[model samples]
Target chain A: MARCRALVRPALVEAVGRLHPWTGEMAAYALGWADPAGTPDPTGSEGKGVRQALALLGAEAVGADGAEAVPGAVAVELVHTFSLLHDDIMDADALRRQRPAVWKEYGTGPAVLAGDALLAQAVAVLAEAPGRHTGAAVRRLCGTLNDLVSGQAEDLRFEDRPWHGPGAVSPDQYRSMAEHKTGALLGCALALGAVLGGAPDRTVTALDRAGRHLGLAFQAVDDVLGIWGDPAVTGKPVHADLRRGKKTYPVLVALAGGGEVAHELVTLLSSGRPVDGEAAELVAALVEEAGGRAATRDEARRHLDAARRVLRETPLEPTAARRLDALFAHLLDRTW
Target chain B: MARCRALVRPALVEAVGRLHPWTGEMAAYALGWADPAGTPDPTGSEGKGVRQALALLGAEAVGADGAEAVPGAVAVELVHTFSLLHDDIMDADALRRQRPAVWKEYGTGPAVLAGDALLAQAVAVLAEAPGRHTGAAVRRLCGTLNDLVSGQAEDLRFEDRPWHGPGAVSPDQYRSMAEHKTGALLGCALALGAVLGGAPDRTVTALDRAGRHLGLAFQAVDDVLGIWGDPAVTGKPVHADLRRGKKTYPVLVALAGGGEVAHELVTLLSSGRPVDGEAAELVAALVEEAGGRAATRDEARRHLDAARRVLRETPLEPTAARRLDALFAHLLDRTW
Candidate 1:
């Protein structure tokens, strides 16, 4: 992951700099490459570069040097950052990565424009990418964007529905949303890398499937952390999902079971008041008592196992397989 | 322009429908093709399709059937509508084409998502276009987007400065902004059409120059209409720009003249009170008396002449030249 990030960061910065001056500066700040005033920030924190890592790994799996996938890596990362910027505004999130969110640091209008510029830049990067497969790569990226937009629209609509009524979210619906929101781009990253590496269509499809499963596992673990991880480490408040009454996988799973604790949890959450600290603690305890935590953990493990099996069945070199396995372990085991 | 709109409307509708369900519906509504409930509205108003006309005209100028540029036409129109959607939100305008704007009818969140989807789909349509020049066409579209973003950023930034202070907008600055915000896409339309029609680089460049000047003339006329046109014809209140304290080209020109009437006008506008019926009429009289109105009209005429000269110098077929001339006259002569 670190190697892939090192290779793609400079190109990503160059691509972003191609935007109009004000937009470019705001986009750079959102990507952690610069301060709010457009000065370079050498010590700024960066994202995990998960999509870039997946792109490189997919390329390597097809017996190509990962350098061929640098454009795809940069394109996916820009799209990811674009989503984050707009999502922060839509969600009205105040903080990100332990700092003020883009919409908070800049005004909402500028932040929206910055995100708009980044989105355009993402497509532009792929369109100008130097490769024989550039056309197919852009189509795949567009498909991913469609899924991302659909997923986000669904998520926002979900927020307006009753938690336990006819329109209430179900676990399957949650998984589907997760696939569209998180899994689609991850899948596209691998597919783009494979296509750029001149892999067979079958191998590319296999890599895409593996990526989707990996994305599911990633989001499952994130959901767990959102509920129980140390706030100091995660940069989010403990039981954050519960406090916000977010209908995450665990909460949906517990709600489906309809046990006494599940009913109590639902009653407390659906009251339409801000969940105080004590209510959050009690809700978390009730969710755990209803087997939600263990169920979610099991789901993550299942996805990780499935992803590993898919990769093993693919015709990847032994070294590539080993590297992918190591990275998977690292991602799932990370404390932060 | 009506002919071009008729030719591109189906393709544009199909392209917008390629987005996710919710986003596609909102985009359709924004484009004035459907109602908020996703029902088709036969009487819905549409844009002038100026960019589409330029693309088709450019194609014809190069001796290709105008149909060859339909994809480019559709792409540019989608981008134009995308900009309109976002700009409406940023400007907080409640109406467009005398109807409730997309953001006003559907809310800002969905409108933003719809715009993002349209932008991606614009590039996607070109990438999947069935022609040898698809790659180059996509690149040109991206470059145009860069200019559009920059133009919008400058326009927004200009709003932050005082109207009569040192940072007040200048006529040259307004022209530069219009060039980016309006001219770039128009230039791109012609370039994309020329490229698709297999025109040489020199001819493409000339067409682009012609398109840019045409765009400038269009905007100049628009600025003039914003202040002096009848509300019944323009679909906006009389002197709408002055009422909003917008530093339009004529206003900037009047400010730069620094006459006694201009000084009084500035003081009245800068007082921060809303310009009512009497004030709007007074400001209009002052601007006209200061020669701002005449100057702006002259500027538009000059640009129209320049655009015509550039088109004439290009080695266009005789019939194509006649058609271009007719369209140019129609655009400048429109009352609304």
Candidate 2:
């Protein structure tokens, strides 16, 4: 993985730099390469680069040179970056990766431009990519982007109309949001890999399904951690979702019966009252009692298992498939 | 123009439909095809579709079948629509073409999606267009889109900082913005015409230069109208630019004098106070006194002259060239 990252860095940098030369500096900040002012600086922040990695991983999964997927990888990363920019603004997030979010650091206009730049670059990269499936690649990238935005629209609506309300959000609705918001892109990541590898339709479908399941499970686990996990590990305050009045999977399951505690929690959240330490502790206690925590874990496990099944069904080589299997296991057991 | 509009309607419907099958109904609302809820009703909405008309007109300018430019026309119109979506959001505009803006009706999330969908379709149209300059066309379109966005960024930034404020924007700066925001796409319209006409580089350059001038003039005229034009005709209140605190060409030119009225207008706009009735009249008076109104008109006229010169230089056939000249004359001379 380290070698792969190293190999793709120059290509990624070159492609992004050339395509978005004007906003490349701002984009560099997004990719953790520079500061907000478009100046050169060391210690640029970086992500786990999971999407890019997945692109290459997907390529390898179907017996292609991982390097060949570099453009596709970059395209996926740009899409993800654009979403993070808008998402930060929509959520009014102050921090990202222990630093001020894009909107916080540079204000809304630049933040929005930064996202637009990334989106445009993503298309440019796909358009100029050196490979077969040029038309298909662009179309797929666009279709995935369209779905991601649609998912965001649904998510925004869900914010004002929480599924759980005084109760909890259903697993189904949560899954639906996760699929649209997160899973669609992940599925695209896998599909791009298959497309690059010149894999058959059946194989692409299997990989895409695997990605979808994995994405849902990943989101479900994130919801669990958002409410009950340690802040230090998750980089967020404990019961943050609850405090923010979010209807995550665990909370929904816990409030399915709409018990007294659930009702109290809902009232506290809806009233916009301060979520103090005592309230946080009580919410945690209620979550535990409502079986929300256990239910989330169980659902996450089921999806992960389902993802692995799809992975096994795909026509991946033994070595590549083994690596992916290990990767999934690590992700499934992620504490953060 | 009426015939062009009619021919383009089905294509617009079909293009947007393919671009967003499910959400296409919502897109129709954006294009003035349907009401906010997808109800079938055309209440004298849908702009003159000036870009599409220009595209078809340009096709005729080069003696190509007007219908041949439908996809190209649609492509430009899509870009135009995307700009409207983003601009409405940025400006917090509540209405468009006498109806609720997409962002106002559907909210920011869907507004953003609608823009994305349009951009994607624009590229798709170019990709599928069976033209010799398809590759160059796509690149030019992308380049034009980038320029517009960067220009918009500059425009947004100049909000708090006037043309001659802390981040004082110069005429050169304004020119760059105008070139991108309006000129580049207009250039694309003419370039698409030449591509269809199989015109030489010299002819293309003349058309492109003419377009650039036309765009700059149009923007300048727009700025002039924003402050001093009749409200009923422009569909904007008197001194709309002054009230909104926009650093338009005239405003910028006047600010260069460092006059008290310019200072006062800047202060009033930045204070977030409403500007209407007496305040609006006062701003209009101040702008005229500062010579902004006259300077803007003079600048616009200069561009119009330059554009006419280029049109004369171009090797367009007599009849087609005459139509082109008339079309541009009307565009430059329009009151609203």
Candidate 3:
């Protein structure tokens, strides 16, 4: 993973730097490196760059050197950035990573354009990448975007529904939604890596399956943290998800328990106010008592285990697979 | 012109119909045939469908039958529809063609998704079209999208910049912006038509040149009517351009003219009220007194004449060329 980062980082830096001045500025802000007006400032708001790392590691898992996969990694990163820009607007999120989200800083109109520029430029970049794999990769990326929108539509619809009440969600439905929402792109990233590495179909499928589970586990952990993690560590207040009545895995599980504590939690979510100190603790206690905390942790473990099983089935070198396993564990365990 | 409409209308209808059910619903609203919720209702708010007609006519002018050019026309119309959807959002318009705009009816997020679906589906439709020229046409359409976005960005920037104020806009800047905002896609419509018609390069160039000039003329005439046309005829209150503080050709000419009326007109524009009735009439009178209206009319005529010359130069069947020429005149002379 470290080796892949060394190779991928330079290309990303150069590609991002050499963009047309205006586009470069936009991309810089997208990457959490610049202010809205293109000033040079990094406020420690950049993501952990997990997606890029996954792209590189996936390539290595298929026996490709990181040098051959940097462009693909950059392409995936740009697409991810584009999604964040639009998602912020759609969700009406004021902050991302620790700074003003794109729409908040630039207004909805410019943010939309900036996101579009990234999307268009991502396609162009993929077209210019040195591989016949480019065509298939581009198509896959487009499909991922469609899935992203589909997932978002469903997510938004839930906000207006009574789905946040007790007994409202199921494991199957949660998994299905999360797979399309987050896992689809992660699968594409691995598939692209395999394609660039010249891996066979079976090898690609194995890597993709591994990525799907990893992404599921990653999302579950994030959702858990979003509701119960400490404010300082998560960089968002505790019970933030409850405030939005987000139907994350833990909330869904608690709702499915159908008990007095579950009823209280549902009421709290519907209250439409910020969940504070004692209330936050009570909500967390209710979530645990409803078996949600344990269930969410268990579900995360199941996905991670499934990913590891697929990793064993792939054609990756032992060292590469080991590094990937370590990366997946860190991803599942990380704070913030 | 009737023959052109006969060829293009059905094609546009079928093509738009192929948009995802939701997107098609939005298209119906854009065309003024349906409400935002996908309900069918009789309405007259549709665009004139000028771009679609031009594509089919341009194809026929170069010897192709309408049947052979349906896909080309459909592709251009989809691009145009997608642009309108996004433009309405960017312009923050409440009504389009007389009906509620897409964003106003569907919300910004859904409207954006609908626009994106149309664009993605447009690519798919173009790709699946049965023709040797399909790939090239689709690529050109993508380029046209890039141009549209660039033009939109400039337009947004223009709103806040004093240099883009009345009298500050040059003819060259006007043409350049219009070429991107309107002319490029219109030219592509003709170019695609020529491709489908199997026309030679000279014929294609002629059609493209003519389309470009016609687009400019249409926009200039639109600017004139924006401030001075009858509200009943235009379907919008008079002096909409002034209220929006748009730097249209007439306003620029009047602003450049050194006189009291020009100064008064500039003040009226900068005031940014919804000027109408008597105040609007007074502003229209001042616009004419400053020679703004005549100057704009002359400029529009120059573009119309240039379009006529392009038609004369093209090696079209005389009947077809005459038909297209008449269509151009009718469009330019339109009062509504």
DockQ of each: 0.69, 0.30, 0.29
Cα lDDT tens digits, model 1, B1-336, are 778888877888798777878888888888777888888877747677888988888899899988889899988988999999888887888998888988899887778888888888888887788878888888889888888888999999888787676888889999999998988898899888898888888988888888888889999999999999888899899898888777788888988899797898889878888886998888889888888899999889999999899888889978987898778878899663
- Quote the positional error of residue A211 for candidate 1 in Å: 1.9
Report, for all candidates in order, the number of backbone clashes. Answer: 0, 2, 1
Give the per-residue lDDT of model 3 (tens digit) for A1-336: 455656677777776664435556777887977778777676767666777777777778877785566777777787788778877887888998888887787788877777766665665555456765655555556566666666665566556656453435565777777886788777777777777777887887788788789888988888888887888898887788866667788878887778788788878766776666777778778888998888888888999999888988666877778888888888787652
Per-residue lDDT tens digits of candidate 3, residues B265-314?
Answer: 76776666766667677777887889889988888899999989989876
Highest DockQ model number:
1
- Candidate 1 regions with alpha-carbon error over 4 angstroms: A259-261, B164-166, B258-273
Over B91-170, each residue of candidate 2 has an lDDT whose tens digit, in order, gives 78887887888888886756766777677777777667776655555656666777777777777766756444567877
State each model's CA lDDT, in order: 0.85, 0.75, 0.74
Q: Give candidate 3's error at residue B332 in angstroms.
A: 2.5
CA shift of B73, model 2, Å: 2.9
Global lDDT of model 3: 0.74
Candidate 3: lDDT of B61? 83
